[model samples]
Target chain A: MTASGTPASTGPASVPHLDVDPFDMAFFADPYPTHQRLREAGPVVYLDRWNVYGVARYAEVHAVLNDPATFCSSRGVGLSDFKKETPWRPPSLILEADPPAHTRTRAVLSKVLSPTVMKQVRDRFAAAAEERVDALLDQRSFDAITDLAEAYPLSIFPDALGLKPEGREHLIPYASVVFNAFGPPNELRQQAIARSSPHQAYVAEQCQRDNLAPGGFGACIHAQADAGAITATEAPLLVRSLLSAGLDTTVNGIGAAVYCLARFPEQWQRLRDDLTLARNAFEEAVRFESPVQTFFRTTTREVELSGATIGEGEKVLMFLAAANRDPRRWDQPDSYDITRRTSGHVGFGSGIHMCVGQLVARLEGEVMLTALARRIARIEITGEPKRRFNNTLRGLDSLPVTITPA
Target chain B: MPAITFIHPDGKSEHVETSGGESVMQAATRHGLDGILAECGGNAMCATCHVYVDESWLARLPAVAGDEDALLDGTAAERLPNSRLSCQINITPELDGLVLKLPERQV
Candidate 1:
C-alpha cells in the first residue's frame, strides 16, 4: 500500500471513478466521510466533474507531495492552471513556483525566518499569548475560535511582520478568499472574494516597504531585495506570501488545538500534568484536524501512480488531511493523542516546498497552549462546536468553552 | 550520556549531552540552538536541517535513504560529499562525540 507506481485499477479510463465534487459546499462542511470513501475507492480516484485525479491515501498523497517534479506546482497549485486560466491573485513566489525560482525565493524566506531570527521574537510572542490567555480566562466562558484563536494571531503576527496596525483586521477575510480560491470558482470562493474585495488592498498595501515598520520580518524581505537575493518586485509578493500564509493557518491551527483539547479531556489533563507537551499537542491537533486540507498538483510527465498512468498536465488532487489520518500509515489514525510522534505527517506538506513559516506556527501554538495549560485546570466544551466552512481550510467557527482556572 | 557536537553557522560549537532515539535536529532544537530549521518538523521533507558529518564519523552513520538523498539535492548550500539531513540521523551511543557542521543556510 506504499506509494507504488502501479495503480489499483488498470488503464486510464478504467481508473477508479468517484463523482464527488470536492469543491461542493456540503463536502467542505464535513470532509471526513468523503475522505473515507475516496480512500477506500482506490489509491487514485478520478473526479469526472473537475476531470482531476485524486490521491487520498497517505502513501499516494505523500508520493504526490514528495515527487513535486513529477507532480509540479509551477502551473498552479489550484484548480485554475496558470497557463490556461487567470489566477485570482498573483501566484505565490514560494508555494506556486518550482526549482530555480522556488530555490531562490525559499532561500531568502528561510534566511529571513531562520530559527535564530525567530528566537528574537519568542519572548514578545510568549508575553502576548500569556496576556491573551489570562484575559480570555477572566471571561470564563467564551467562543474559543473568535475569543482566542482569531484574537491571538491577529494581535501578535501583524505587529511581528511590521505591518501597519490600523488595517490589520483584513487578514482573516482576505485569507479565506486566498485559501478558498484554490479550489475553483465555487460559491464559497466567489462570495469570499467579493466580501474581502475592500480589504484585499490592505493586504497588498501592508507589504509595501514604506508601509512596513522598521526591523520586522516584512522589512527583512525588503532587505533581501536590497541584498540582491530577490528582486524588488518579488519582495512585496514574498511579504504577501507571509501574511496570507502565516496568519490563517496559525489561527485555524490554534483553533484546532483548543477544539481538540476540549473534545479530548484526557489529553487536556495530560497537558495540565506536563506543560512540555504544548508543542506536541499543537502538532497532534494539526494531524487530527488538518487545517489546510487539499492542494492540487499538476503532472509534469505521464506518471504512473497507484495503478493508472496519468497523462502529463493532469491535475492530481492531494488530500493532505485525509493522508494524515490514513489507516495504512498510522495506528488508531483518527484518534487524537498528544504523545503520538507526529513525524511524517503531510500536515505542513513535504519535499522542497514545505511550510516555511511552520516554525512561527509551532512557536505560536506552543506559547498559547502552554500559557493556557499553566493557568486552566480543565477545558470543557460548553456547547456543540460549529464548523467553519472553507474550500480548503478545515476549522471550527465557534467552539464554546468554559475553562476552570487553576 | 553520549555527546554530540553541533558546529553552528557562526562557528560557535554547542556540544550537547544527548541520548539515543532522538534526531540530531531534535537535539539541537531541544537545547535551543540556532541551527537546523526543521521546517516540516523532521518529516524528512524540507532540507533545511542539512548538516555535514565529519568523514571519520560518516561511516558510522546510516547511509542516506532515497527520499533524504533526493531532498539533499535541493539544499541551499552545495551538497557536500558528507551532507545529510540531521532529522534522518538518529542518535546512537556507539557514535558518541559525533560532530556535524551546520551549513551557513539550509533553505
Candidate 2:
C-alpha cells in the first residue's frame, strides 16, 4: 500500500518509540548497542525526544536513500526544516539540495574531483604519506588520532584545496559545527558553533576564487563557474561545501581504519601480508566503522517505508552506520575483514547523494595505510583510546598506539 | 527475461537473466557477478564498473555523454573504443544477448 493510503494500525501512534537520546555523549561513545536496539525495534521507530522517524535496518535505509523523490534533501538533511526555519549559515548547495539544482552543482564538483585529477595529486599524496609514516615510525608509539589520522589529512588536503595554511586548523572545529548542526540543539552543537565562530571568516575567505591556488580543486570549481557551468555565486558555496564536508570526514575515516586494524590484529596481519590490500582494508574500515553516521531526510510526501506510514514533511533519520552492521545484508556484519567485498556498503552512503569526495578519501586512506603496512610489521594498542564526540561523525580524539617497523 | 553475459578477466563467462530497465551494473551486482564494483551506486560518478562491450554489440548502446564520458577516461583498465561505464547502459530486450568483458581490476 502506498503511504498516501494509511495502512490500518501503522499510524503514528502505533509506531515503536525509543526513549534514548541518540545525540547524547554516552550514545556517541558506543552506538553499536543502540544501533542494534534500533534495528531490532522496527524498520521505522519514533524517537520521542526529537519527534522524528528513524530507519536503522539496511533494507529500510537503502530504500529511503534510493527514493530521493520521497525522502528529499532540499528541506535540509537535519532536524531543522529549511521550509520553516532559517539555516544558521547559507544551506549547502549540494549536500542539502535535491535535483536539478543538485545536478548542476554536482556535475561541476564531481568533474573537479574526478579520478583523473586524483591521479595527478597521487604522487604528492604518496610522498606526504611516506614522510608522515617515517616520522611516526621513529616515535614507535604515539596517539594515532592526533599524530597519524588527524595529522595526515590535515597535511595534504588543505594544500590540495588551495587554502592558505595559516588558519587551516579551523577546518576541524568548523566541520564539527557543520555536522553537529544537523542534530538537535544540544551542548555539543552550541559549543561547536561558538568554538568555530572565530574561524568562520577564514573559511569563507578561502572559498573565494582569488584565494584558491591555480590548478587546485578550489580553483577548478571557480573555473567551472567561469565556464558557465555554475554561477559565480554558486562557485564559492561549492568550494565551501568541500571545506565544510571534506576534511573532518577523511580525518575520522583514516582514524577509524587505523583503530580497526589495531583492535583487530589478525586483520592487520592480513594487510601486512598483502600491502596491496591497503585500498580494500580502508574500504572495509569505512564499512565497519562508518564515520559519517546518521543523516536526516525530510519526507516530501506521505510514504510507506517497511510497512510504516510516514507523514509528509516528517523527519526520517537514516542510520547509515547502523545499516553497515545490519546482519540482514552482510554476513558477520560486525567483523572487519579487509578481504570482504564491501562495494555495496553504505559507508559513503548510496544513491545520487553518495559522498562525492569518496575517491579522494579512499586515496588518502590507501596511501597512508599502504605506507604504514609496507613499513610497520605490527600495530599494538598502547593505551586507552579516547573517542571524539560529534553529533554526526564517529571517530577517536586520541588513539594511543605503538608501531613496530617491518 | 533478458540474459546478460559477463566475461571475467580470466575468460570465464557467466550469464545472468533479469527484467528490463535496471542498468547492467545493477543486474551484475544483484547476481553477485565478479568484477562489477558500481562504487557510486550507478551514478556514472565512479568508473569502477567499467566494461568492454562485445565488438558486435557496441552500436546497440546509447552514446555516452556528460559524467559517464568524463569518468571513462580514468577507469583502472585501459579505455577501449568499446569502453563504457556499465551503469549507464540500461537493460532492455534488445540487450538480451549482450556480452560485457570485465576489466582485470576495479579500484
The numbered model that scores best in TM-score is 2
- Cα lDDT tens digits, model 1, A1-406, are 2386545544457678888988886887778899999999999989988889999999998888888889999999988889888777778999999998898998888777765665688899999999998798789999999999999998899888998868777888888888988887878888887787677788888889999988899999999999999999999999999888889999999999998898889999999999978988998999999999999999988878876788888888999999999999888998999987676688888878888888789889989999999999988888988888888899988999888999
Query: Quick one: how many clashes does candidate 2 have?
Result: 0
DockQ of candidate 1, scored on C-alphas against the true complex (2 decimals):
0.13
RMSD of each: 7.4, 2.3
Query: CA lDDT of each candidate?
Result: 0.86, 0.89
Give the top-scoring candidate (DockQ): 2
Give the TM-score (vs. native) of candidate 2: 0.96
Q: Residue A336's C-alpha lDDT in candidate 2?
A: 93
Top lDDT: which candidate number? 2
DockQ for the candidates, in order: 0.13, 0.59
TM-score (C-alpha) between model 1 and the true structure = 0.83
Cα lDDT of model 1 overall? 0.86
Deviation in angstroms for A343 in model 2?
Answer: 1.5
Name the runs in model 2 displaced over 4 angstroms. A1-10, B17-21
- Shift of residue A308 alpha carbon in model 2, Å: 1.5
